[model samples]
Target: MTIISTEPQLMPFFSDAFLEKTARKCGFMERLRNIGPQSLVLSLIAALSKGNCTSIADLHRQFNGMCLSEKHTVAYKPFHNQLRKSAFADFMKTRVTFAMVQLIENVLPPLPKKFEQFDDILLQDGSSFNVHPDLAGFFPVASAH
Candidate 1:
């Protein structure tokens, strides 16, 4: 069985450090130390592939699905449930805050120059987006119970 979903294999553009640093700063380190940030990102990527980015409920479903998966880190010992529990809900709230900051950091590129010529136009600025809050799980379950 292909336990490790294909999303991680497919999306090679994502940066590991970004997720790690963001996750750590946000306090996901304790909850996902052994699983690591990359796995969390990978699982999140896999689950979010099934839903729309703009839907708030979709985020809930994706994380729940991934956490329930045997391959996901939470499966071995499902401590928190952002969907059906309060503790997890608070935890998720913090995660969401950090994730949003990380996301914005990712999409908006850093300012390149201190100044630009007025007469001589310099074309600058590009757009990038990975619009899924659900891309925040470890692996996935080998089988759903």
Candidate 2:
């Protein structure tokens, strides 16, 4: 598939060295094992891009499928455990931040004079939802008595 071909293009943006460094910095990598940080990150990106991977199990399958050999394939539990770590979020955040910085520096043009003063521009949908009464203790809401 084109997925295999496109991976080489992505390597320039998300290099193996950078992925390993960030993973180590974020405490996601203690020591390199069967499932390296690069493999995990690339597999995740590829799986998500396909849009068919709806669960962790699906992701696990995709990871194994991407492996070059049977020996490199990880078990479902180990794969799940790797992603369950608290540092997983930090690891992903670092990667995303790096990518965004790279895009801003190399790809995107400079902002106009008026907008240049702002560090970042944020847009949010002003959507709100009511929590169930039973969840009030867990999710407290502000009220005007």
Candidate 3:
């Protein structure tokens, strides 16, 4: 069987300096240096995306595999507890969303001139939505309610 690597690929969008700046701004970094906030965030993303890591134990395993040095390791409970904090949760959500937007902006091709006429373009994916009662005259419902 071919071995698959779960190590972080060092994404261009998530640079070390960028993550560090975000972590510092969010107050995730204090005095200790071994397990930096950036490493924790990157490891979490890599584990969930690559190894299909589930429980805190699996998180530890995935993180350990990505580590270059074997000197220090973050325990599962501490890592879990840290992630549970509201501040960290908000920070991760904002940063991840920002990263995704940046990635799309960088990789996606520019829109055609016809589409570019609009100030904004929203692309949503879901089942058809019901029309408001105000527009019932214009658009009748397909099925009887």
Candidate 4:
């Protein structure tokens, strides 16, 4: 059962202090303008929800409906294009995953894979596609033998 709320509540609970601290440490505040570090977080979440999403029109209709603060609202085709097309998603995911790897690498007890230092290398991967039914045509294929 889904209940509706009139109040614009926060979906992912994050603290302003936490964001400010991380922003200063990671130097994200240098590049981001107008919006806060948490804005990047919200956009990242929007982008993920926008899987198979192409074009900013889709992004606006999809993410803008969410309960974001007016300042957090994303607009302009350029913003969506920049978020989905640029290396932003990959970069964010890489940073987060790498941090987790570094943390859990030594902690959280050990597992069978932990013993395999030979394959200790960690890999991060990403992909995207369009919602268009004819999207497969966009994929490249090498000539068959």
Candidate 1 residues lying further than 4 Å off, grouped into runs, are 1-13, 52-76, 79-145
Candidate 4's TM-score reads 0.39
Give the winner by lDDT: 1 or 4.
4
Give the Å error, residue 25, model 1: 1.0
The global Cα lDDT (0 to 1) of model 4 is: 0.52
Name model 3 segments beyond 4 Å from true.
1-12, 107-145
Best by TM-score: 2
Q: Measured by TM-score, how close is model 1 to the native structure?
A: 0.32
Q: How many clashes does each candidate structure show, in the order listed?
A: 8, 0, 0, 0
Which tens-of-lDDT digit does each residue in 1-145 have in candidate 3? 1122211322533677777777677776555466666677778888898756668787777777778877777677776777777778766876878766755664578889899779988875535666677877776653223
- TM-score of every candidate: 0.32, 0.68, 0.61, 0.39
Q: Which tens-of-lDDT digit does each residue in 49-139 have in candidate 1?
A: 7665655344434554556455543432342332344433454465556556644664576665754434455563423333244543432
Would you list the clashing residue pairs of candidate 2?
none
What candidate 4 gets wrong by more than 4 Å, as runs, is 1-15, 31-33, 60-63, 67-74, 77-95, 98-145
Flag the better candidate by lDDT, 2 or 4.
2
| Residue pair clashes in candidate 3 | none
Residue 6 lDDT, candidate 3, scale 0-100: 14
Computed on alpha carbons, the lDDT of every model, listed in order, comes to: 0.49, 0.81, 0.68, 0.52
